[model samples]
Target: MNNLIDELTPEEIAAGDVAITSELVPWHFPMMNDNVRNDAYEKALKAALKNGGTVLDIGSGSGLLSMMAARHGASHITTCDFVEMVAEKAKIITARNGFADKIQVINKLSTTLVPGTDFPERADILVTEIFDNGLLGEHALVAIEHARKHLLKPNAQLIPCGARVYAMCIESSEIYKNHRVETISGFDLSAFNQFSSYEYSGYHIEKSEHKALSKIASIFEFDFLKDTKDESVEITFEVTESGLCHAVVYWYELQLDKDTIISTAPYLPQLSCWKQAVQLLPKPMNLTKGETLKLVAHHDNEAIWFNRL
Candidate 1:
């Protein structure tokens, strides 16, 4: 047997070729290990495939979702991933799992796929899990929009029909330190703060020492079945506790189906593979209880950000 890892030079390994087989690996295992996420998706797939129909899976990492659809009696499944390595691996995985004949793996982006060329015809169901920590960071909106127009049949069922995003102000020195640098070892290292990420950063809110300064409020909602565009929305939140507001923490409720929902909210009893997103403020604001704070949330179909108003 040929060993693939042995073919790579030491330089290639150091260059992240072997260390990171695919950018998908970081989250792939976590997602596969998440019983809550897996169960919810399995349940949704069963419900959608109860009647047996052709399914199109976008961003089908490891072909897990596609296999799930197959297990639930999908007549056939066409799954695609942008990463060539991921697609190749999925093909082998599906074949080994006895789904080689039921599922077809394509190495291309869903947006680039042609209906007849990619598959025999438009699929009757669309299932995908292309969300990032902040929901839109994986270009999910763009992919779903394109797939709905060119790949899926009219009124095709979406695994996750819609999603609602929620946000809340928080006071957390631990989370703030990850983004802002002030002084270290009596030296002013604040100059490096310019490199801090303006976009939302991922963090496990339940694991971090933090306090909720304001009530969590729904800020945005997206329907995967409909066309969407870049949007900006301003939301006002009333402070419930007096403290230094260092960041705005956000999570999403993923509506896998009418009855299946999974959330990344910190209060949830189980920890999900997806972490809550934290948008650090330029500077911490001393908030007073009963005061209202306004912030604008913007999404450009890919990235999301927040700005104080």
Candidate 2:
């Protein structure tokens, strides 16, 4: 009998002539390539563990963060992932990293964890990379709230202590193609484009592809240590340049601690795996300087969506 995990369909090879297999794990590529993100977390953990404190790592993909906590001499480290497949791999990876005894890997969601049953005590510090490009796209609000209620101490510190989401109105024909349906073969298929869908357009885009038509607007922010969060909100931005507004470009600033930070803004020296998310409007609208761009941003079921009003 063939198992699904063992199945691989012949497909075109990407980079280095390596065909992405069914066994291709999504976590590994980013974990290895995202040195900036990892370095930020590692620096903060090193400082936070200086005096030696207990740590709890949520969404502990491959147990890297938990291992980082362990490597830095945290008094104790506990990690958990929502999937059993990831948890099992993390368990083995943690051991191979010589952190088996220092860290504990649980194959369950952080929300399902109870202090008395899952650990001897609440965590003195909570660390997680539970964010997507749009910031709240991964249900960080719900998970962190639940963890605050049951998993963390009253005064626990948080790595990536805070985060902010910024939005900018843009004129990008290249981006509009991603979501809008145009005429196909000289036939009006526009009606068949009956619906629109949300998407994540990671920032492999060039600066020439899109022009910013507005000053950056701060749409959302999260202080992991203190905020419970509001998922639905409307924000307004004033156009700084006269242009056709085709999309909203959003990025994040992650405060790993007081001093370390990372951003996915396209203008930055390098882009992160969690690239800027593009929210394509239903159609292009001609916008002018000082014009209004009202946006409603919200999240449901761990997915974030943006719309213009």
Candidate 3:
């Protein structure tokens, strides 16, 4: 959100501690404060490290996961972050936490990591939390696939073994107004809507008033330990409530292990760091009960989107 940076006062921006481009600072705080997310990763790390092995942590913000691996008795840990500032802070954090001997922080992308040069050898465990609201928007598929092939040992354990994305059609003029520009105050402002995004945008669905028009539909599944490619598929949902479909709201369940799952479902009581993604349709479609809504769900290995068919 550029507004987060734009809202900063001149004095604050001039402060030595402030980073103008550090929009990620706001994100890191919420994620680190999320007990559900932190606890699940800790549990997964403990389970994955039961046999004792080295770990490779991608997107190591603050080096928290890497430190967790070290605490779980991982023999060695190598972590990386593409952001130079975050990587530097992670190194400082690891050292201050007394894990400097066990964890190595790299200021480079995981995609650029080379075995035997970046670290002693391929790691026996891979732990990472690089997902966005849409799951694939941060290129988790590309990074994980590359790690599996070049940075991890054969049969290496994955903290989040996989994930499944789900979507449901919704009717909410309140939400639609954010993306659509129509007649306002007797003036036609609809022409400005040409700049509106057709792609999905993240929102805290719990804070938004909306009515579900269709049952949730499973759209895609990804296995972190396996190689994957860009994919597109047609998914159909049966309308349960007769209403105008304004957008497709989507969320995901992250499978840390077979038994450990963290969900961003709007119905869940706990708030998640990752918000639900909403893809507003170009035009609202009126539907009756029992009608079928077909959507083409596609991911380009980085971002995800849905289109009415």
Error of 1 at 223 (Å): 1.3
TM-score of each predicted structure versus truth:
0.92, 0.86, 0.92
**Deviation in Å, model 3, residue 254 alpha carbon:** 1.3
| lDDT digits (tens) for residues 118-206 of candidate 1 | 78899999989899899998988888888888898998999899999999999999988978989899999988989987788888888
**Could you tell which candidate, 1 or 2, scores higher by lDDT?**
1
Which lDDT value does model 1 have at 235?
90
| lDDT, residue 144, candidate 1 | 87
Indicate the TM-score of model 2. Answer: 0.86
In candidate 3, position 233 carries an lDDT of 99
Candidate 2 weakest ten by summed lDDT: 8-17
Candidate 3, pairs of clashing residues: none
